[model samples]
Target: MALYGITEREKAVTVTHAGVPHPDAECHGVVAQATQNRVLVVFVSALQRVAHPPAFADTDAEVGKH
Candidate 1:
């Protein structure tokens, strides 16, 4: 993913819950994945030009955009 110089802040914004995307939301998908340390507690607004960050560091590998 670093090959793209992709960062989370520019792509995904944090959300509170699994609500329908707002007109202002930019996410493309939502997935629930397991983590190593602990399960994550945040939601991500997916991006097409870049990949989204894991809800928790060291969770699944960063989820990619479609």
Candidate 2:
């Protein structure tokens, strides 16, 4: 269960898209792999950390209800 520095504990990975949890794709006994030439690598930009460009509505005095 060990290869390419993947320990037995890391042999399994929770299903995710761009590192975002995807319960639909999760499966027991599934094995995930990482390769330099494949699309298995995922990079996620934290939503709360992302800086969205300011919009004109940001200046509006009225705040929208949640």
Candidate 3:
């Protein structure tokens, strides 16, 4: 889970991977920081609702343990 800070006034998105400013898309706010576990949980939950991917079922349990 990579953290990004998007500046609407400058229309730029900043990430830890690069020092260069990336042009922002149609977005409202920025994410200053995010935890890998939290992001993965949300991702897997969405996948479960839409695709129900088999691999992710096990991961759900693993994530809960953590």
Residue runs of model 1 more than 4 Å from their true location after superposition:
1-49, 60-66
Off by over 4 Å in 2: 1-45, 53-57, 62-66
lDDT of 1 by residue, 1-66 (tens): 321222344335334322223212332222222222223313332242234333332322243221
Alpha-carbon shift of residue 48 in model 1 (angstroms): 4.6
User: Model 3, 1-66: lDDT tens per residue?
Assistant: 122333443334223223222222211112312333666556645544566333233333354447
Q: What shift in Å separates residue 45 of candidate 3 from its native position after superposition?
A: 0.3
What C-alpha lDDT, on a 0 to 100 scale, does residue 55 get in candidate 1? Answer: 31
Cand. 2 Cα-lDDT? 0.28
Task: Rank the models by lDDT, top first.
Answer: 3, 1, 2
For each candidate, give its TM-score against the true structure. 0.14, 0.14, 0.25
TM-score of predicted structure 2:
0.14
Residue pairs that clash (backbone atoms under 3 angstroms), model 1: 27-46
Estimate every model's Cα lDDT from 0 to 1. Answer: 0.30, 0.28, 0.35
lDDT of 2 at 4: 33
Q: How close is candidate 3 to the true structure, as a TM-score?
A: 0.25
Candidate 2 residue-wise lDDT, 1-66, digit = tens: 334333332344322212222221221112322234233323222221243222212432243222
Candidate 1, position 32, lDDT: 22
